[model samples]
Target: MRECDPRIVLGLHRSRYERRILTSALDLGVDAIDTSFNYHGFSAHTALATAGSDLLPRFKISTKVGFFPTAGQAEHSLDPDRLREAVERSIRDLGRAPDLVFLHNPERSLTGSSAAAQDRLGMACAAVERAAAEGLCGGWGISSWDPRPLPRLVDGTLPRPDAVMVRAGLLAGIDVLEASEALAARWDLNPSQLWGMSPFGGSATQPLWGKLDPRVFIQSPHDGLSAVQATFRVAYWLPRVGRISVGTDSPTHLGELVDALRYEANLDNLSTYRRLLCEQRDRQPL
Candidate 1:
């Protein structure tokens, strides 16, 4: 399978100005766009569809399946029939096949036992493969919230993944932070095949630094870099992190991120920031 552009991925979550954000990101040379069937009542995919065919070919498109959004409560199911229907709906909604389709938070769909989860995952994988074979998608993967099952997936104990998306960032407070790094090294996968979600530590609404401990802040200022830039830099500079997904409706915020991607963090400052994160992680209760 071909790798996504290594620089940045524009995350299209539920937000205002969804179309504008996507267009601006493409204009700024974002390598890919990430969205799911449930984002913004499925308007996220519709926005891209409305962008016309010409613009669609410019960037790689990725969307997730298995989760359905509704008025009262969100729905989660990985039934093969449901998955097939989702894939078809996604293709129709986007007006084109996605470059990649992920099993959106498959962990949540688990019944009870590990064996049950594995069986469900296997069925989902088969469904995804059928989509790929039918040209509805070029490839498929797991947008995993949990990392425990990844080693099995990557090692061929489960279905092979074309890519792996996980919540990863510089902040120690985020779940799966260390596990993501460890998995990247241990898995038989290229950095380009590893997609880092929430490089800013969380969604745009709830940022990682919102409740961060003051001591975790960089004691020394990183020259010409904002705290946000510094934080993004840590994930961007990691050798094993291929694509970092950032979602924003503000063009100015998007521009700042684009600029930040160009500025390499000073190695000394980066080292200190990493050390602080490690210390914070050590202090956490197991």
Candidate 2:
């Protein structure tokens, strides 16, 4: 088995939850797995326990809550009682408390005025925070697909999350990158406290990946790394996140992701790219 590397997380958001993938992850040093209460049709935790209860302890597990089953449909909720119950249920299903659990897009249920949103968000965070404190999980966090409204709601009164996960990659727009940064700053989070997800905008096989040469973002453009690997590596600098959650069932594919980390990102090009993104955003109609 390879030494564990925490940087590359095996995200189960779009996973098959196969036993082979879990074993492959352990072999490749990608020991951290990110999943959710509602994944695989709300059976993710049980599936994980069934597939690799023995391997679960070997991996650092992170998961999400906030979506519940309603009449056989998934519904978003921030009700503290419901959220608290979910955390407990997650522990039961996984057969172990998760190392970290996120609010799972609190922004989805955050509708109405800013103050109302703030109130909803604060209460929801507090509930998860209490769960972590109670040993229901190791820690609590916030995972936002679109973090635009979160920064403003964070103030002295809101319960602080241990970490934050946001979308990262070349596809992550200026609005998302800036908002994620702003939220991190508001919470006084270091780079390590921030995690990124959906590095390929949900899939690497998209036609857009064929159009753009991702090597432009790498410092050494001729190292024989595939463009998909280059795009994954560049994701770390897109918003300066320390850990990125990527999903792949193939061990070969997982090894490719781990190997991509060896290449250094061209910070100068990334800086220039961010500047261009901001400039273009500024020119757009609000």
Identify the runs in model 1 with alpha carbons over 4 angstroms from their true place.
1-5, 51-54, 69-71, 149-155, 172-175, 182-187, 203-222, 237-239, 265-286
The residue pairs in collision within model 1 are none
Consecutive 10-residue window with the lowest summed lDDT within model 1: 213-222
lDDT of 2 by residue, 74-191 (tens): 9999999999999999999999999999999999999999999999998999999999998899999999999999999999898888899999999999999999999999999999
* TM-score per candidate: 0.81, 0.98
Give the top-scoring candidate (TM-score): 2
lDDT of 1 by residue, 1-286 (tens): 1233357887877456345666677667775888898887766677667754567777788999978766766899988998889999988888889999998888777757767777777888889978888898999987877765544433345556688788766642333655666666555668788887777656533554555532233334435656576566566544346777777778778777776665554556556666777787789899
Candidate 1 TM-score to native: 0.81
Q: Which stretches of candidate 2 lie over 4 Å from their true place?
A: none
The residue pairs found clashing in candidate 2 are: none
The candidate maximizing lDDT is 2
